[model samples]
Target chain A: MTEEARRSPERAKRLPRAVREKQILDAAVQVFSRHGYHSASMDEVSEVAGVSKPMIYSYLGAKEDLFIHCIRREANRLLAAVEAGIKPDLAPDMQLWHGLRSFYAFVAEYRESWTVLHRQAMSVGGPFADEVNAMRERAIELVAALVVSAGARRGLAEQAESSGEGMAAALVGAAESLADWWLDHSDVPDGVLASWLMNLVWLGFNDLVEGAVWKPAE
Target chain B: MTEEARRSPERAKRLPRAVREKQILDAAVQVFSRHGYHSASMDEVSEVAGVSKPMIYSYLGAKEDLFIHCIRREANRLLAAVEAGIKPDLAPDMQLWHGLRSFYAFVAEYRESWTVLHRQAMSVGGPFADEVNAMRERAIELVAALVVSAGARRGLAEQAESSGEGMAAALVGAAESLADWWLDHSDVPDGVLASWLMNLVWLGFNDLVEGAVWKPAE
Candidate 1:
């Protein structure tokens, strides 16, 4: 073996367990995002991580366990990114706008992470799907809090209390659906995507809080 | 055995294939909705439909095939219901309002079918998920046409043409997410649910057509 190649394994062996685990996870996410769960291989993950397969197994169990870890890690990262993007001091609309911008930015920067957490984990179904769903619920709850607070600000606490969670659910779904659409239509910038949603949802919500409602003429 | 008990199989035999198929699908949807695809049993479906297991197998192939059939039937029924609800003579807002009402109505009337087509089918993943996704795409396209036409009415055809599909995807996602939320919070009637969405989306869409937009303050 070449000197560097021979020493690379030795160098990997000296890394701390947590650092090695991160390396494995980073590689696993990449592999899973590319091949999906069913089609992804441990060998490729091993080769990509520059860590031995046995080391990966010891660190993260088997393929299924490894895939789940990738999902949970990526999901946490996404939620944290969005949460961090929201400046609590801002108006609710600005808070939501910043949140959406952070979300799309994350999706844009870590395309593979988004793919693994969203498309791959979901298609694999079972526990993997449950993980994604749980993350989605958290996101909805986060937005619901914002919606309720905004309504309370407008002296419509009762109305917002009743519908805030539901509206948040719809908004979260729209964001997710739009993100999926963006995967195919990547020509659209992330800022533009966030703006489109803001135009669609924030203005609509602004009207609701202002007591302007749409009624059928008939 | 009683005469009716003894002759039931022969009576089932005498029924037309289409009628029998409907019976099986109805029962399958009910069972699948309750137990989901994997946990659902052919025995339960046969018992519910009053058809023998052998007949179910012969008609629908197997559990996988049966689930696909259920998804297809329910999807078609849902799309037809929404399309039929829309009157081309009405304005775009009215048309969308009618469409959402019809969709929620269908969910209310055929809760089992919707449960199977959306929750059960999606969680099953693989080919079942594909069927549900195909239905969603068709639904998006249907809404996109309406959005584009609405923009045309406002003389903003170019902007509408550019963003119509993405907006439609978001709208469909919102409708679906709200429907899921409604499944848990059903005290709100379907009409109210439709109106909630109308307030959330239509008003915002109206603002877009009117050239009013939300901008972030630096």
Candidate 2:
């Protein structure tokens, strides 16, 4: 029935489902960042993505589902970035350094994604919050595994292994807080930020693993 | 307005304005922690505090203002606890340890206040975020001053002093993150948690101050 319209140049190049979903997410992020979750609307997202409202609803489901999809996509992207950055062959410290560099770089490049994941997703305080928290826990476990495996190899991993979960959780929080601070202070390089955290946590951690505790002097 | 009502045993011991405000803030912290800022109500806060709705309005203004008041008061209390715990005469490590101990203890004892400050305050963007962030910076500066001045005394503080702001910011974040994690893992002692963070960050910071860098191995 619409053969003529379909043959038109404007409709000649139809996007794949993946490409269309990506476009929708990009626009949804911008809209969500602008208006927040409670105030953001699907119609605005549809208009911004240049897709029909029905297309968005059919592809992404409801607004909450769409928002959760955005969070999941961004979370996976971030985790993938860190995973890709760290070379398995590299030393533990170097692995951490590379991982952190990728992390800060992701935050620098995708401020909207980071904001949605770090702030808006957590603020919602429902199923979305649980999803984000689960993602966070996964990230922490990744770091803890790295720390424990590295220390075990060096024969310096005992104490850290014993309390690796808590330590890893704290490290994730610190990185998150630093990234949030970086939003306002964008002049600093991502490497330096990563290195600062690496130095702050890794060295102290190394020392502890070696049984070199920094005790209070009388 | 009746003399008989005023003379009743239940009304005989009316709190002073300062005491009443403290009671209101405590109640606000609990309610805000439970329901969050948006879901929490003035009527609920008044009822919880055992005060009149008019009293809450007259004393703390609107909902937003009351929330800010609660944040400010709780923030001051936290900082005060840290300040009181750290003696100026103590060594840097000891000073930091003491400060962190008090911080963890405060979080453990006043989980509701900490929840309101850390989660609810930061979740709400705009003015509330700014206020919480400002208070956060103040806390960081306090820690930075402690770190810097102590290093300077031992002739090891110059390097740390240069990037002191960033270092302090990260340290504060790590501590905050630890406290958040501590909420779920309450079995661990506050002193132990504080000590873990102290070992995790302070020792590395000390090494950095001594010009020991954890460089990426080629």
Best by DockQ: 1
Q: What are the DockQ scores of the candidates, in order?
A: 0.82, 0.49
Top of the candidates by lDDT: 1
Candidate 2 has which clashing residue pairs, if any? Answer: none
For each candidate, what is the lDDT?
A: 0.92, 0.83
The residue-by-residue lDDT of candidate 2 on A109-134, one tens digit each, is 99999988877876665667667777
For model 2, residues B1-218, the per-residue Cα lDDT tens digits are 56866676335556788987888888999999999899998889998998777878888888999999989888889889989988888777788888898999999889898998887876665566667777888888898898788668767766667666677788888898888788888888888888889888988887876778888777
Give me the chain B TM-score of candidate 1: 0.95
Q: How high is each candidate's TM-score?
A: 0.96, 0.86
The RMSD (Cα, Å) of candidate 1 is 2.1
The DockQ-based CAPRI class assigned to model 1 is high
Tell me, by TM-score, which candidate is best: 1
